[model samples]
Target: MRFDYSEFSGDQGFLSPDELFAPPNLMNFILQYGEQAMDAMANLEDEEEQAFIQQLIDAGLLEESTDEDGNRRLKMSPRLLRGLQHRALLEVFAEMKQGAKEGHSTREPGRTSERSDGTRPYRFGDPIGELDLPGSLQNAARRQVHRAVEEAREAGVEVPRGLRLPIGITPEDFQLHNTEGSADCATVMLIDLSGSMMRYGRFLQAKRVALGMSELIRGRFPLDTLQFVGFSSLAETLHERDLPLVMPKPVSIRDSQVRLRIPLEQAYANQEKIPLHFTNLQLGLRQARQILSRSGAANKQIFIVTDGQPTAHVTTHPATREDMLYLVYPPSDESSELTLREALRCQQRGIRIASFALMEDYWGMDWVGFIEKLTRLTRGTAFYCTSEDLASTVVESYLTGKKSKKFIH
Candidate 1:
């Protein structure tokens, strides 16, 4: 018996260039199918769809640009990108009223000007001013009493019910005035680029969320840093401007079980040799941790949007003590273990983790369990939802984390 294979071809002949779903609309069509929208537009001839192109020009959202091949193509203005980004977030806010009871709507941030009743614990780089003397003394007194009670118990002595005043304040007990929006944050958003994400329009929702988050951080949380890391067989940093063009890697290999170890240097040199559809969350979290370490923000957090458990991870080769990619299929326990270890490392660095698990599959139990274990180990939050719930869930997580960060430091 002989097997034959040839270059795969897509059936685009029936698809017309003017048969576009989204014509620069910020809502359902463009945000969900940006690549198709662009491709459809690019395929049209110069004289074709003149009215539609004119409309885009009239709206000041479209411009002309030359491709690498020196051919002219339609380009979207920064204004259009800004509009799409802002609209994504606005849609989330709009969903808040409808989905708050779903356990995703967080306490809205910027609720009040200042917290007069309490003082938050001081962090290393907090602004120094009138220290909350009462709050400081209270923390000091609590610590002292706790130590005293422990000592008394160990020595079999009765503890004094009343404690003395004039509690000396230590650095640990120092508290800063609680302000509504005082703390700066560094946020890393890890988006799954696994092949599983290609189903049920999952990647579209993820892209929309990333864009919204990028804009939300830029416009609302100016001091906060937002990084998007996409993970598959490898992890790579994604920028906001290039997000729309990004898509989940199509499954390139089909095997019941797979195991491969590729040298990191070699993989980087010739990336086309390796498959890019397996989830490698350990590398994603590691990238996020490194990016956050460089940020000067007082509060750091990671938001992971993924649809499946990790199937691949990177490990340092014992002999070389250098980076290497460990790929596996059927989601080996080893892969999950390595990913969870990285999550733990993130938590140990005072970074909060929030996992948004997209459960569109009936066979989602394995991934949900992994998410549960991750949250447990990191002392973080987990949200189980579908792609439809992603916008509100992401918004709630972002707002919830932002407001609650006041207590973290």
Candidate 2:
């Protein structure tokens, strides 16, 4: 067969390698554009284009899903979502070059047979087979030399041959190699879906980082727990399959200096009439805290990724203690203060928070102080970077800030 090469054309052979659909590019496009990309699929009219999409369905990347109206719609298959997550993880790891190993390390040792870097004095019942022979023998020889010198000196011996101290291994000289420690961790990642996040490519990068974190926990630290919470006017737990379709809620109300409050129950009843552009950090933190309270993991963490400060916060009525949602434009003090208060509550519950602030096209560091203050209040960590560096920054923060849980013996 002769080699065939030509300029790219939409009418070219479908089976040709060059014409074959690339899954990564398609997935990336879908995730980057979110729902809009999926909607675009309905506009294809050519048979070849339809065949191309059919190929994706056949490959198990996309599937026919029904909407609430019982209409057939194209939705991402779980396999595709997993592939994107795995790709994001690989990209982040590639950028980081070297990082922590797969499994989380526990502070307590001697639970497993795998050897770690350090050794400790052997205790009764510790497997003798795991003893560090070199260390044990060294200890025995050192004690022997010290005693031999003392005996020689006491005898006033000036012989060329030096007398040695106690020689040979004893129970006291046995040392065991410290076994590898592994611990499970519960992590909740708060992603900002505020209108501002749709700018500077912030939303896409944050979403990518979240997906990457999911895969990292699932593939490497299987024992660790992971969840993603996207917060706008309210917080909602996101499933892995729906991540690619996620997008920042558009700004429906643009009025300046606005203040509104709705009872939580009423808000749920009129969810479709509610605005979705406000940043509700308070509810997000609370939801995460509540989710983690059920986990028995050794460590718990909350990762916050946002491009702006909280523009809204959830509260309770003073007298009835009824749940309420508050929205304030331009991020009023009431909103920020409430968000910080929620963060303090998280701190009291022993949840570690790491806030990643996206500073692309931002006016000043002053605007970013809310998250910084929240971090300080929680005694957590803060990272500032542009959308371009968000993935690497988040990945590095997660890997380096990991703390092993200590076990009570």
Per-residue lDDT value at 240 in model 2: 73
lDDT of 1 by residue, 212-302 (tens): 8787778766777888999988889997877876888879999998999998888768778899899989999999999999988878899
Task: Give the TM-score (vs. native) of candidate 1.
Answer: 0.72
Best by lDDT: 2
Tens digit of lDDT per residue, candidate 2, span 48-112? 98898888777676777778987658877777777788788877877764645544455568556
The weakest ten consecutive residues by lDDT in model 1 span: 102-111
TM-scores, all candidates, are 0.72, 0.81
Each model's lDDT: 0.76, 0.79
Give the CA lDDT, 0 to 100, for residue 265 in model 2.
82
Off by over 4 Å in 1: 1-30, 46-48, 57-59, 98-112, 115-181, 402-409
Index of the highest-TM-score prediction: 2
Which regions of candidate 2 are displaced past 4 Å?
1-22, 65-70, 97-118, 124-129, 137-171, 179-182, 402-409
Q: After superposition, how far is residue 318 of candidate 1 from its true place, in Å?
A: 1.6
